[model samples]
Target: MKIVVAGGTGFLGRHISRALLDAGHDVTVLGRSPDKVSAIPQLRGATATKGDVTDPGTLSGRLEGAEAVVQAVQFPNHPIELPRKNLTYDRYDRQGTINLLSEAERSGVGRFVYISGAGADAASEKTWYRAKGLAERALIGSGIDHAIVRPSWAYGPEDRALNRFVQIARFSPVLPQPGAAPQRIQPVYVGDVARSVARVFERAAWNDVYEVGSREVMTMNEVVHTLLDVMGKKRAVLPIPSGLLKMATAPLKALPTPPMTPQGIEFATQDGLVDITKMVQVLGVEPLSLREGLTRYIER
Candidate 1:
């Protein structure tokens, strides 16, 4: 099988590309910068192509012979450094996804797997969720066979979220959290996410949305403490109110790639745990526990 993975150089995309290659499928990564695409240790046999999904014309001949298309591209965390107008989520998460779906349809691609985040609501007032929700609706309505995999909180080597906690815990005596610090999340390992996506392609899980997560449902405070313990650090947990977190993240609106957006902060304060029974039973995937997942990434 020939597979084309958009955003194949990203955190989870790298794992997915490698898993596909290891499964004996021909893999091609589609990214904007060809020079940025290198032969990853996990994807030694795969190829890379230079193309932007935001512009449908660039992807004309690139996806010609692919049997499956995995849309994994997303906008960077925030619009702080970039102009707010150009950095809007609609451009990439929504319009870019639509453009890719159109091109995939044009090329007669069969299986379409989308890596959408959990808690995306089309009717939500939040811009990011709305964008993802709109794109999801379009994909399902496009008449193409699609599988939407929504992971709770993805963490591993190169992970953006949990790794931050590990890094901060390494030197800090106390970890500051927001909103009661009880907001639960089931952080799934990147390799497990990759395995589940590959399994979906292998079994042709079409016209369904599968939610994936780790084996443990932990509070935000618990996650931080666990990472601290894993790294042999002694750190106390402090829970701040949600209002303060929003105010703290307000200044980051000017950053090009902010570690925390006001929207993301709000989302983080909410419960992000999901039911992964389908992925576990149908896909036959068992994700790592939080402690196990973080230990492999942050061996401190």
Candidate 2:
């Protein structure tokens, strides 16, 4: 099989590309910065092509020989959109997918896979979920044999999400969770996500979508404590009142590359629990529990 993984240089995309390559497929990593594969030893055997899905013009010839196309791209500074640079979820997640589907049609690609997030709803008021939901719809309507895999709070050593807390626990005795909300999340290991995406190509029939996540459901505080316990750290989990945290980070949005934004706060507080039964049944992937995943994450 010949496949193109868009955003192959990214955190999840890199792993997906490697998994496809390991599956004995000819993998090409297409991204805005495809040359990043030079630094990624795991992507050694895969081809790297520079392309941006946000612009249809850039993707015309990119998927020419690809039998399968995977849209795994996300905007820079994710969760903290740089609207000034047109780096919002609507741009990269929604329109970008529409562009890729157009090219896939032209290129006569057989399959399309979208890496969507949990809680995706086209009718939602939230831009992130709405964008992904809209993208899922576009692929379904494209007449392409498509599969959508929605992962819940994917985390790894290189991931930007969980590592933030791990880094904080590295120095401090107390880990301050950004919000007091009992935000439910099922953190999936990145490796499991990559393998599940690769297994989509292995199946005899394609399911419309697979929502992948750990079987273990946990809250924000519980997640942090789990990581601390895995790291042999006795850090206290401190939850900040949402109102105060929002007030504090609201002003920082004015700064370029603001460390935290109101949207980021909302992103941190949102619930991402999903049923993993479909993923297990279809993809044959039972995502690792948060503690099991953290053990692997920290050991490496």
Candidate 3:
């Protein structure tokens, strides 16, 4: 099968590209920067094509002769700030997906796989989740064999979520958690997500949405402590009031690249748990626990 993975240079996209490549499928990574494809070791085997999903014109001819299309493109800095060129969730995730689906449908693509986030709902107040929900709806109604894989908070060596916490723990004697409330999350391994996506294509699970995640759920506090343990460091975790943290970082949003934003804090504190029964039964994958997954990157 000839597969085109949009945003294939990203963390999870690269993993998915590798999984498809290992399955003996011809893979093409469609992204804005074709040069960055070599940076991700997993995508070395994939043919890189430069294209911006935000611009429908650039997507033309990219999907030609492609049997399957994977909508993995996302705004790099999500939930924090708008991307350069005024790209928002609606423009990138929602409209970008619509553009790709349009081109793929024109090319008579057989399969369309979308990487949606957990807790996504068309009626949700959150912009990110709402955009993903809209995109999922578009894919299902596009008259193509589509599979939507909604993965929980995914983490790996190159992950921004847990890895940011690890970087903070490295320098800070005390780590600061957002809020005192127990924020539940099931952090799925990136590799597990990739394998599940591959299975979706191999099995041709059309018009279905699979929530992929780990079995165990942990709180924000627990996740931070576990990372500390994995890093072989002991840092007193201070659960600061969410309001105060947001107040402090409110001005940072003005910067081109803010380290943290209030919206990001809200997303961090929210519950991200997901039921993985279908991910196991359908995809035949048992995702690694938070501890086990963390151990792979953090040296004890």
Candidate 4:
């Protein structure tokens, strides 16, 4: 199978690219900076092409001779939108996939795989979920044979979320919890997400959306405690008051690449509910447990 993976240099996309390559598929990584593809170890054996999904003109002939196309692109700092720089979900997640889908259709692609979020809702007011929901809706309406794989808080060595906490735990005696509320989340391993996307091709007639996540649904406090245990570190879990964090992330809205925004703070605290019935039954992918996933990436 000849497949073109948009944003193959990204965290999730790189894993998907490697999984497909290991499965004997001819993979071509499409990104704005194809030269940086060499820096990503997972994209080592894959071909690189200069194409930005945000710019549809660059996508011309990129998906040619490709049997499948995967939309796994993310902005400069994922989950943290820099609207001033036009790096929001509306631009990349929503418009980017739409643009890539247009090119995929023109290139005669057979299958499309979209990496959607766990609680994506087109009608929602949230930016990330709404963007993903609109893109999913577009893909379904495109009348293309596509599989939507919605991962639940995917974390890995290269991930920005959980790794940020891990990095804090290594240097500080107290691990700062995002919010005081028990924001439930099912953290899935990046490898499991990659595997799920790759397994989508193994089955026939998979046009439906599949949600993938671990068996454990834990709170933010539990997640960090478990992550600490996996890293063989003992730290006090200190919950930051939501009001204080919200006030602190206010000034970040003005930065070029804001590390944390007011919206991002809310996004981090939201519950990520997932149902893996189709993931296991249809795709035959059972995501790793949160503890198992943390152990795989965080060294003890």
TM-score for all models, in order of appearance:
0.92, 0.97, 0.95, 0.97
Query: In model 4, what lDDT does residue 123 have?
Result: 95
Q: Candidate 3 on 5-94: residue-level lDDT in tens?
A: 998988899999999999999999999999998778898789989899989999889999999999898786766755554647888888
- Candidate order by lDDT, decreasing, is 4, 2, 3, 1
**For residues 1-300, what per-residue lDDT tens digits would candidate 1 score against the true structure?**
999999998888989999998888999999987655675566577788988987888988888988888988866554222435466667887898899988888889987888887777789787767888888999899988898888888888877777667666767787877677478889888989999999997887778888899978888888877878788888887888888888988887677567776666777677777889989988889888988777776776
Off by over 4 Å in 1: 78-85, 252-261
Candidate 2 per-residue C-alpha lDDT over 34-83 given as tens digits, one digit per residue, 9 for 90 to 100: 76888997788999888888888988799998899989999888888889
Candidate models: Cα lDDT each: 0.82, 0.88, 0.88, 0.89
Q: Write the per-residue lDDT of candidate 4 for residues 206-298, one digit (tens) a residue.
A: 699989888889888988888888989999999997778989989978877777888888888889989999888888887789887777767
Clashes per candidate, residues 3 or more apart or on different chains: 4, 0, 0, 0
- List of clashing residue pairs for candidate 1: 80-254, 80-255, 81-255, 81-256
Query: Which window of 10 residues has the lowest lDDT sum in candidate 2?
Result: 202-211
Regions of model 3 farther than 4 Å from truth: 83-85
Error of 2 at 274 (Å): 0.8
